[model samples]
Target: MFSELQTEIEARYDIHFDDLSLLEEALTQANYINEHPNYHGRDYQRLEFLGDAIMQQSSAVYLFKRYPDWDEGRLTELRILMVQTRSFAALSRELHLDHYVQLGHGEEISGARNRDSLLEDLWEAFIGALYLDQGQDAVMNLLEQVFFSKIDTGFYDRFVDYKSKLQELLQKNGTVDINYQKISEEQIENNEQIFTVAVQLNGKQLAVGEGKSTKDAEKVAARRAYKDLTMDK
Candidate 1:
């Protein structure tokens, strides 16, 4: 199973793993260790931690060079958005990294293999493995290949802080007392939670949004409020 994946990664990413074991460790979730008593101590948690830092640094450098005009605050915000959990999870899905993850029998049966948090950690673990196998250059190359095309001037321009924008619009129109309330939450199928948020401006409900999380739902609600407030005039 891993042999074909190894070959595919090598061919596509131009990375040759010096130690296949490292790659194996990257794909092994903690749940896998619980299933095999002999492998109880083996887990990818540490690798995920190291990979997370490596990815953050690599993305910061990439953004620095790509957007020289951006100040530290702007760059930091962009970096945060780029390396966010949602972004990493999305990237994992694009690379089909979930297919290569190793899960325990119970986790596999429970479909934990496809969980976003697992996929995000797997992506970081793979980064750590690449860093150890080939060094920073190889890892940088892989990141560039996967993320460079997605970076553009528009990414900077369109990366507005919806919350800030909503607050600004509300304040300018004498509605500075806007509040975001979590109306409800539901665990949908596939272990995902759906949250609904209501955006209230000056004690009046402006808009509502539903999303996979309360934060996402609030952001969407803010976006809707922003649009409505801007257009109301």
Candidate 2:
């Protein structure tokens, strides 16, 4: 159904796709097959499954060699962060994978094209297809090219603390000065005042929250602001 993209994808990656059928399967969404009962084309689900396992192993090996001093617990956390949905989605977007994905009419109308889960699954399926088409070495090289680029730039560190993440994201546009402004303090039944805070970006209110203290309120506000500014898009 999406044969048009075969040429563009190959040219973009400089790949001579031997198994074009597998590549097509990797780009096919389940919805596309479900919508066409007689269609013989396979969905990306199986490829996504294999890709996930390969991604986990590759990330673990990379982390093990890259951080020799870190213990198991820290290494595991770092690996998780590196292969998380957000990370996958970021890489997919960077690769412009969305342009090549095939979607059913319903999914396209519902705005599923830019969904993080969908992007992540498509990325994994692409990895699985690449692994099948070339080998583990090719998949590893592609992953390192994308994932390692982020690692070298300390991308995961920004998300280690969501508050720091929100701040960094807001600060990307130098003109928009962001701040967490305390709105009010109201005494509760226990005589403890609940602080309400608003995250403002360039005088515009991004999000608001209430907590037992100013610090707590700021964190809550930051979390909400992060979700609002990021998830909606």
Candidate 3:
């Protein structure tokens, strides 16, 4: 299972794990320990937390240097999109990282090994393991090859929250009232939640959007609001 991933990483990212044990530990899911009493209890959760921060900081630094002309708000929006779970899941898929994940009998039978959230967490754990075993430079190189290399200026621009841009536009135009309200929320399949958000301006509904989270839905609604407002003007 891990051999395929090793080959994939070597061919695609040009990085090889020197210590196979580290790689194995990195890919070990929490469920893997539940089934085996002899396994002596080591999981990737701690590493995932550490990697999450590392990934955020690394992406922040990269974006800060790459988009010097972007304002703070725009940069923040871009960074949020970049570090989102969906983005990490996409990266995991691109690298076939799920193949290397180790799950116990129950999780494996339940297909949790291939879950986007689990895969994304494992990917972050893998990054944390790389940082510990090799160093920041090695992890950075791997990130550049596997993820950052594909990010273009246009991609960042597209991912930015248009609602923020609209806010600036509205402020410039002497209008300051903007708000978002959550209309509904539901738990969908695969442990995901859906939220509907209404965008309002001056106490009137502008537009609405449904997304995986209230914040995401509101952002989408804000984008639509921005479009509607701009077109009206």
For all candidates in order, the CA lDDT equals 0.81, 0.82, 0.79
Q: Best-fitting candidate, measured by lDDT?
A: 2
172, model 2: CA deviation in Å? 31
Model 2 poorest 10 in a row by lDDT: 1-10
lDDT of 1 at 148: 60
Ranking by lDDT: 2, 1, 3
RMSD of 1: 7.7
- lDDT tens digits, residues 1-233, model 3? 66677787888777787776777777887677877777864688888988899999998998899989887886786688778776787777777777777788888899886687887798788888788878889888987876677676334434566778767876896867888889999988898899999977788888998889888898788777786776534
* lDDT tens digits, residue span 159-222, model 1: 4578897887667747468788999999989998999999997789999989898888988898
Query: Looking at candidate 3, what is the lDDT of residue 124?
Result: 89
- For each candidate, C-alpha RMSD in Å? 7.7, 12.6, 8.2
Runs of candidate 3 exceeding 4 Å displacement: 153-233
True-vs-predicted CA distance for residue 223, candidate 1, Å: 7.6
Model 3's TM-score against the true structure: 0.66
Tens-digit per-residue lDDT, 96-116, candidate 2? 778777789999999888999
Per-prediction count of colliding residue pairs?
A: 0, 0, 0
